[model samples]
Target: MTPQPGSYPGLTRRTLLVSAVAAAGTAFAGNGSATAAPALALRSGSNTLNADFAWARKRALDWVQTGKPGTIPSYWAGLTNRPAFYSRDVAHQMLGAHLLGLDAENISMLKVFATSATERRRWYPLWAFQFDGGIYRTDYKSDDNFVREVPAVFELTEKGVRQYLWTGNRAYVDDAALWKYYTNSVTYFIGAHDDNRNGVADEDGTGKIFQGVASYNENGEGLLEAGDGIASQYQALLAYSIAQQARGDEAGAQASARKAANLRAHFEKNWWSASANRYIRGFTKAGARTNFGKENSWFLPMKGLTAPGPRTDAYLDFVHKSVSDLPPFNIEAYTYLPETFFRWGRVDQAWKWFRYVADSRAAYPEVSYTTIGNIAEGLLGIEPNAPASALSTVPQLPSAVPWLELDHVPLGAHDLAVRHDGNKTSALTHHAGPRPLAWTAQFAGRYESVLVNGQRQPAKVSVVEGRTLSSVTITVAPGAKATAAV
Candidate 1:
């Protein structure tokens, strides 16, 4: 079983006290600038479910703050020791922040990092930043001295695409600095770091993090390329492709897509180990593969780079069997598990880890925010493309949650509600928006047809990430509701 926050005997109360003081001073008592309290709510038939959801939801909402008058919109995404946000943490917590109606904060913070990468720093963004937009000194002494990791660069680029998908924000494509960042992250950054010329970014292979490291696993050293780094690069290429398509750059989109395709193909051909029947985690400077597990093993599937089949299933099984052993003590690392399982359509395993992290009661800011993100993106499976005014959902509710409803979810121009009644039925309502919403209500498994508001519609069957989905698209006008059943 995963350990709870209380397991660390000396720190829980003190951490909570500090977090409360921080929240009260900035987020709750801003110069009348903080956004209104998040109206989002999660409810279920079970009392335990309600209680758990409320605990995480409230804690996450408390972290929202209008920082120190001059800072960009901010939320707690790092340790409580300082008023700063870490790149890895912020990128991971983005969905939860967006769900809380912090789109401006997301835009501000992401842009800051997006613009901070420079040629002098080899195109790596600083690892963490103070709320006031200064580089966090503790992590930076000079341009060459900061906590830089390979996965963070690509993760931020990929997450920027996530923001565009959720909000349909044109600035993601139109903004000069952000557009440059997206292009640089995949092209220039990789060019700067690929020592072996393998078309993937690599750290210097000294294994020292301050100089450069390839993976989020800081302690794993001497790695030229880590699984998480390469996997994230692949996704970043895809994200850039999506952003280019949104910008009407067909040639640019196809070029990025081809790069992404080649990267996936390369990973499929090279990373798998037939004897071990699992993906090797990383490579050393000497051209040797290492299966260090943890981030190296799980990040491949989590980033959607794995080809779905027996090999992918076996790796997920390996992850499930060894999850509790994932290290560095803090529960924040385990937060990645829920999304990893969801990527492969393993709902039971997804819920298991979701509950594990949600129930851990960890005080680290990433935990609470990620708990909410998992509810929407993992268990509920929401995919939004606001530019197109479209939304899609796949229900992954476990048996424990007979019915689940999330209300006041912010998506682009609208506030919406989504409900799942087990795996058989799902519903969405457009609460507030100028135009009607194109809702694609999706469910697991194959079906001959589906019922939309009890009217039969031809069910479209398709494979996505190796899972079969039966879906029907409908227009949900403002203040109207639509339901679909398989």
Candidate 2:
């Protein structure tokens, strides 16, 4: 049964107020309902660069609201000229929305894309859509515009499934209409475009690295193969696998998983340059490696395809070295590098780049929204795994900032408020859902014990990419206040 538009309701103010609280300690329980807590509020002042943070937060909230209906709910790429839902721009925008916990807005936009079928066939959407649900342009034409048919439809479908993962709302996931669109799009991408039958979709025999009309660099000119396109396909395969698993299709999930693995292997074998110590841009038609440090090299790590080590470190270092050569807020690399560095525990470098985008106030939704996502998801590391009933906090607090706090973070059926000060941490969960929730807190430094609701729990130490992280996990009842101290 497909859920109709507006089927899912937004979170109420009462729910937000009931979930916000300032506390310390951990309390694990099997059965508990949400309890009344302080209203949700973000902390202000010197530690957080309150003025800039406040502006970014408000901008994200306001920008999401500006989304108007098109074939699917769509956001304008920019305020000045482009007034359509572009395939790549919308994907980045929706990802930012998800990071900010704007589930409803994200879902609305997803529905628009999910249901937009091509005119020639009721399957995939065209490259772009006007505000009135009309096709603005497509890559269907041969010659210069041929790249439009490069199978970027999978990117939108992947994001749609990601929205379902974040909200765990059946309205988006189980909607028959959306699944039909998603399955058909994936099928079309595989059957018509994947000429090699090796699980990767290529551009029409162009011998370019990526055959899509759009490149992550935002340069829609020429027929150069792009690393970004290949990485996007890899992500699409993984996302499809997740969708399959969610529907209890074990064989389908396994098949997609195998395909993703094969694609990764293929990408590494062909694209990696051992001498350069990082993946190059892409290969030319004559099997020549374009050995330049293009921004897309960062995409591999951003997609979780790279393990943490010297190679990953070298990649980050390359990005750092390349920054001076790039324009101010080089939209392509800037959008992703900060989050990548933060996730890999390079807080100093992450903060440096993050400050650049925050200061720029770039108007492109793709740039600004991604900057906002970096602050929330990158520095704060507030990952909401709703389907698993868990919220993971891995704060990358830099040396300059003494503390940081985020309030009213939407998790499935709950609003989570988290505050971290140096090595000590505090959190209050206002669970609106019927069941209890589990929480995990990760710290970069070494910690022997973590106090949960004032009771000490043993901390587990794990090394990720050469950096040691101490993590503690505990279960909290709905409406319970818990805190951890290292």
Candidate 3:
């Protein structure tokens, strides 16, 4: 008889690989000192006062667990009661973990997972692991019997690039295991699962999740390929392209880029449903399109796969309505919404969902970590290219926040402070770093010039998500300050 997929009846949003069964000897807190306080801080003053932001920040930082001597760096990103970190949760929580100065943990967790996706396992990494680098047996009875989903693989691949951008960690692009994993995720891994030969990974002719489900929405019906999975694949391919370029493999980079473009083009052309007025959720094993709203439907735009236009706008409006009318049972899943709204320039919606998630669940580790990340990456709009010694700020300050400041934001070698006074004026201070950073100050709408350090500079204009933006790049030396205003 065939083995059944491990059950997770208690979890509304189960892991890509997880088991409901409890594993003995794994029932302990993380293997680390819980005393270390995160150096990262957030502040709000004047009209921009919102205690919710402060509350979430503290709660997020408070969850940090400093690495111990004998174990790899670790944190709690999975079930609050479990002594494990999950790939799905960790991939989602990574940016916040990095901001909290948990770089070692991020690197260790990512590398361990990368190293685990060997040929023997068909390129699927173990879903979760104990803090001490041991596979969490609850989620893994054996390679063939473990639960596995499609989105996590590509999400991990993309997140590796995200971490590299923030930390400028050469290990992301240079590490042998990580580089191999990234390549395999986009190539051999996808190849192994593509039953239709459509250039996208689907189920391996088996509908059973233990064999590999094609979606993050574990409960979805009969899915052979999912929007979330394909969207993640697009991102992973693009990330692999960037990794290739970073490694000086220009030809490989071009090839990966082409693959990403083709995949996106194929998705756009085929995935949209004329009758539904939205993209279908996934395809069934019977080769039928499933029209539904869930991770499968929303992840398309969330992954930056959808082009900015009326279609995207309509879909986002639908998403906001869907979540607002009926919030998800799994609060952890809500963490993805703010980033979704922020990506499309819907500031008010983004903040609403951010605050909502913050207020809803405090125990789930991903909630706290994502709250921290959404504020920095979403509201403050901090984008770092540490490899180039550069940073960009596009403040998405809602009317509710008139002024906000974040201090000790780790950007690779630099610990910088950023403040947003509404959406018009912004400031950056290079608190600590080895070299000056090229800071790009971006403001919505077109302007001939912007005031930088009280001096006028020409603005470079561009359009994104159907909104005009004017930006100026200024160099901020260590122990110095620079301010930009429209």
Q: Which candidate is the best by lDDT?
A: 1
| TM-score of every candidate relative to the true structure | 0.91, 0.80, 0.89
* Per-residue lDDT of candidate 1, residues 274-366 (tens digit): 776778788886664645457877898888777767878888888787775655455877889899888677988998888888778787888
Candidate 3 lDDT by residue in tens digits, 409-443? 88767778999998999999998776788888998
Residue-wise C-alpha lDDT for candidate 2, range 186-269, written one tens digit per residue: 667556555557545554434322244324454433324456666666667666666666665668866766766677677667
Tell me the lDDT of model 2 at 34.
18
Using TM-score, give the best candidate's number: 1
Candidate lDDT (C-alpha), each: 0.78, 0.57, 0.76
Model 2 residue runs over 4 Å out of place are: 1-41, 44-48, 64-74, 98-102, 117-124, 137-152, 184-187, 195-198, 204-211, 218-225, 329-333, 423-426, 445-448, 463-467
Model 2 clashing-pair count: 13
Could you tell me the lDDT of residue 419 within candidate 3? 95
Please give the TM-score that candidate 2 achieves against the real structure.
0.80
Indicate the residue-level lDDT of 189 in model 3: 95
Error of 3 at 388 (Å): 0.4
